[model samples]
Target: MSGQIKYQWRITKYNPDYRDENGYYTLKEEWTCPSEIGKIIDGKEFTLEEYLDIEAKYIDTLIAFIIESGLNTLRILQLSEQKISTEDRSSVLYETEFDELILEEDKIVTLNDIVIISKMILRNFVHCQLYLKDRFFAHFGWDYYMYIGSSEKSLSAITIATERGLFVEEIDSSPYYFLEEDTTRLVQWSKKENELGMNEGDEELLEFPLEELRLIFNLSSQHPVVGNIKIKIEYKDFFQRYLNHKMDFDKYEYFFWGGY
Candidate 1:
């Protein structure tokens, strides 16, 4: 051909324990092949095959590196929010690849010992296209979420709420409250006495512990809760006062974590 040629390669293996029915990975490492190998317009031009044959050696070098240095650690990051660190070092997630290099019958790491590696990397990527695709989905365990709020932060509509008695604010609306052994989903709502609108007074904080709050709702099948996701739910009723506001504990349910 008279024009320049570019390519890419895909290397994938499936483990039933780590993949779904369709073989999508639930845990995986990923990387990309190089693009831009300069131009054929004015540079010394060779046949496309000649160009590719020369480029293949670089990929070979990369595979050799994989067999030598190990892959990065897998971080169990928040699938819901982005955290900013205040340290001098800029922290970023490391890309992971083949978790534990599985060797062939013989355990060895070398280019000559292709039979030892569980995945065949050197032989792959020989003909892939040059552009990077959005393989964000390829990162394992990066899925599973129900988006809430208009903020850039994505919180699920539901979470395991525990430590039911104490609530502290994270954002004006969010609570830090999750790192405890307990958990919960934060739900946005209007305060009881007001309909939602920014100009209106800020909605009252939802710190009423669940134990006492449940009584106010007289939680029942008819209770106006945002969630019924749990199978085993029990009810308790108690009376308490907040600030100067006093109300019967038998008819209300403060915003439960399971709802919007």
Candidate 2:
């Protein structure tokens, strides 16, 4: 019962799929917890609770160490790669929590409201992607690339390659984007197509205007630029007697007033 506390640590190599001669691998270190007084320090003597606690603490410590080490590591890597932005390799760890204040069931629908909600959702998705990139790619030897969007069925999504991963940005849509005449029509058409067992034979048959809102981020970019690069409008919206569609055709009307 009076044995002195001892600690053991070992560092091992980490190999990822997308490894290159110049690419770096992680150095994983295993740290065993202090052994109990009377218990043998073998695998059988480790209790679940004690093991879990030690594992959790050890992982937390590892994350912190990785973050600190990554700062210098990333700098050197960037320098070697001829990249200037140090923030590009910053840790992407992010926390997502529901905001009660932004959860109102009813609010006056406006173009601004739609834009705000869309931006918030996009920002959250970007943050999460960045965090993952830091954890998996930056921390390990792999490269992480992502493009997040609202729907895959969207006509605008046609240009995206299927191999690339897609993530749906979630946000409260009812308050901002009202279920107006056009939306109702689209839903009805969609239901009709579903009931008839009609395959999406032609792009013109779909009612939802096929318009898609998208955001793409390139983690490998030296500047790490995130922007609304492309907008594709598939269908025309009829307000009163006037028809509005085609991003370039109705630039003033939609760009200035319509919520994107």
Candidate 3:
């Protein structure tokens, strides 16, 4: 009593209009679980208990692949536009089950630990799937980025823009320069009194002297809207600091948002 099973987890969000008196939208989360007959995996039909075991094994295998492949860092992107906010390496570890292992100086955290924590963060915090390089790519940080020592040198962390119908290109300097034009981009700017009794604002992009990492965005004249802009960051320097505890969750949030 077994055949090939096509299984998937689905989440459906209702429109805002479909809200309850409490102003909550209807969200449906669904998945199929075999209640009677066994499900076929590979060439073998497996009972519920056996299927669960294989499912866990498959997940573990994927985790092992990520760790063994040296995928130590994760790029945190905004869900709506996939704007690369910042890189994450340690914060998830501190928040997840690996906290004590991470906090203890005597204990050494491994690549496996980092990957598992990152996966958990993406699932629980971001509510996003933990996608591999081939599955998910990013295209909004810097102009050009490559991992010096990895075989999968693709800019997976900065390819979302192109996939989402935006072209990416390189410019002379940091994209933070746009902060000058976009008032909201800056946390604050100085307003000076002008000769005409008007207030002239003196604005500058926020500076992070220790930051070798730069946020890169490609803005096309054709599509001038912020939604069309794709962004990413040079994460190597930031990741190094994160590993050494030189950067923490609070600092990461500040840097990600460019201040409060």
TM-score, each model?
Answer: 0.17, 0.18, 0.25
How high is the lDDT of residue 124 in model 1?
28
lDDT of 3 by residue, 1-260 (tens): 01111111111112334558894444432122323225554445646554344334333433433444456443322233222223423322223343333321112234554444333432232222222222221121221121111123234322432333222233222222222234232212112223342322222233332223222332122211222111122543534343323322222222222211
Which 10 residues in a row give candidate 2 its minimum summed lDDT?
1-10
Off by over 4 Å in 2: 1-55, 70-260
Q: Kindly report which residue pairs in candidate 2 clash with one another.
A: 92-131
lDDT of each structure?
0.25, 0.24, 0.29
User: Tens digit of lDDT per residue, candidate 2, span 200-229?
Assistant: 221112332222211111123221222112
Leading candidate by TM-score: 3
Cα RMSD to the true fold for all candidates: 23.7, 21.7, 18.3
Off by over 4 Å in 3: 1-29, 32-61, 67-109, 115-119, 122-150, 153-260
The numbered model that scores best in lDDT is 3
What's model 1's lDDT at 191? 39
Error of 3 at 78 (Å): 10
Query: How many pairs in model 3 have backbone atoms within 3 A of each other, for residues 3 or more apart or on separate chains, i.e. clashes?
Result: 13
Q: What alpha-carbon RMSD in Å does predicted model 2 have with respect to the real structure?
A: 21.7
Greater lDDT among 2 and 3 belongs to 3
